[model samples]
Target: MDWGLVLVLLLMGAFGGFSAGLLGIGGGMILVPFITMIFSARGFAPEVIVHMAIATSLGTILFTSMSSVRAHHLHGAVRWRIVALLSPGILLGSWIGPWIGKQMSSTVLALFFGLFISFSATQMLLGKKPSGGRELPGTVGMFAAGGLIGLLAGLVGAGGGFISIPFMGWCNVKIHNAVATSAALGFPIALAGTLSNIFYGWGVADLPPYSLGFIYLPALAVIATASVLFAPLGARTAHRLPVATLKKVFAVVLYCLAAYMLWKAFH
Candidate 1:
């Protein structure tokens, strides 16, 4: 293991974790592209680097989410009832997402990832608040949204927070509460996506050492540990900071990163 690589991984983990804690994001939106770039620069197989990056990101978020959710829960912002309503669909979607991802060509997957990031960036930039409504989404809408979120999570190895938070807000949940609940959703998405990645990549030959399916264990370990320590700090910061301003800045950063990833995907 190169010390440089380890250090880079740790820095990425801290950045990603801190972003999650402060922004109510899943961290994959930032982490995946960053990891892909690092792996590419390190001479990892171009064909597999994005997949591995996404999978490893999802695995890392499993731990990161725990810390984030705990902090949000402490603030009394999580909506457990909503989490219960959407969980089954999210779980099912997570299982199916990786299977779909496995069948796509690497180039196609890269393109898909680029597009997804672009969309997330756009959402962040717009920062449109939902019109207030207190009624929860109907059962059908809840399942449909959860399934969609799950599918995206599995395919992209994200925590689905970028999509989930806004959707919850539109469904009439308060923004802070929506973010908090979305953090809880990360757990199932990560678990299901990790399992799917393992099964989908199982027995593939010539993989990098210590890889479990698409995930790199060393990266996962480094990222997960550092993220867990920082996530609480981020959550606390969110409560104290001007979140609207922070979100705008974060959106700009995401747009820049997304543009870079798209360039990498094509060139």
Candidate 2:
């Protein structure tokens, strides 16, 4: 393995993990675009690059989510009841999402990826706070939302926090609690997405060595290890920093990255 590539992966992991911790946004918004660039630069088959990027990003999220959730739990921020309520649907949806993704053409997936990123960035910039007065959604609604979130998670290789946090907040959950519960959801999302990717890409020809289906194991290892180690630190920093300012800054960065990704996809 090239040390240079390893270094790049580590840096990507650190940035993505830190952003996840600080903003409660899933790392996929960062990881997917960066990984796509890496794969493209490495001269991988254009047809397969997006799939590999999404799959690898999901695999890495498994570790980062564990670390982030644990950190939030330590601070008593996690809402276990919410996690329990939403997870069943999330798990099932996550399992099915990648399967659907596997059927889509690469160009369509790239466009979807760009649109989602832009939507997430707009949400962040709008500065919308959780409604904060109503009860959690009913069982059916919760499950439906979870299923939708999971499907997106698997298809895009995200932790689902981008959707989960906002959805929880809309249900009148506190912002902190919403983010905490979303963190817990990440584990299931990552697990289902990873498994689906494995099955979806199995037996495909001309894949790079060291791949487990669409996932690149070496990249996953380097990113996951580094991201996990630093996640707690990022969470701690969030407590001290002015989060609104951070959110705006992060939103700008996301927009820039999204633009670059769209450019790459087109040109």
TM-scores, each model vs. reference: 0.96, 0.96
State the lDDT of candidate 1 residue by residue for 1-267, as single tens digits: 788888888888898888888777878888988888887887777778888888899999899999999999999988998888888889999989988987876677777888888888788778897887557677888888889999998888788988888888777787788888888899989998999899888876656889999998998999888899888888878888887788888888888777777787777
Considering every candidate listed, which one attains the maximal lDDT? 1
Off by over 4 Å in 1: none
Model 1, residue 74: what's the lDDT? 99
> Residue-wise lDDT of candidate 2 within 53-170, one digit each (tens)?
9999999888888898888888888899888888999999999998998888677788788888888888988879655576678889889989999999888888898898888778
lDDT, candidates in the order shown: 0.85, 0.84
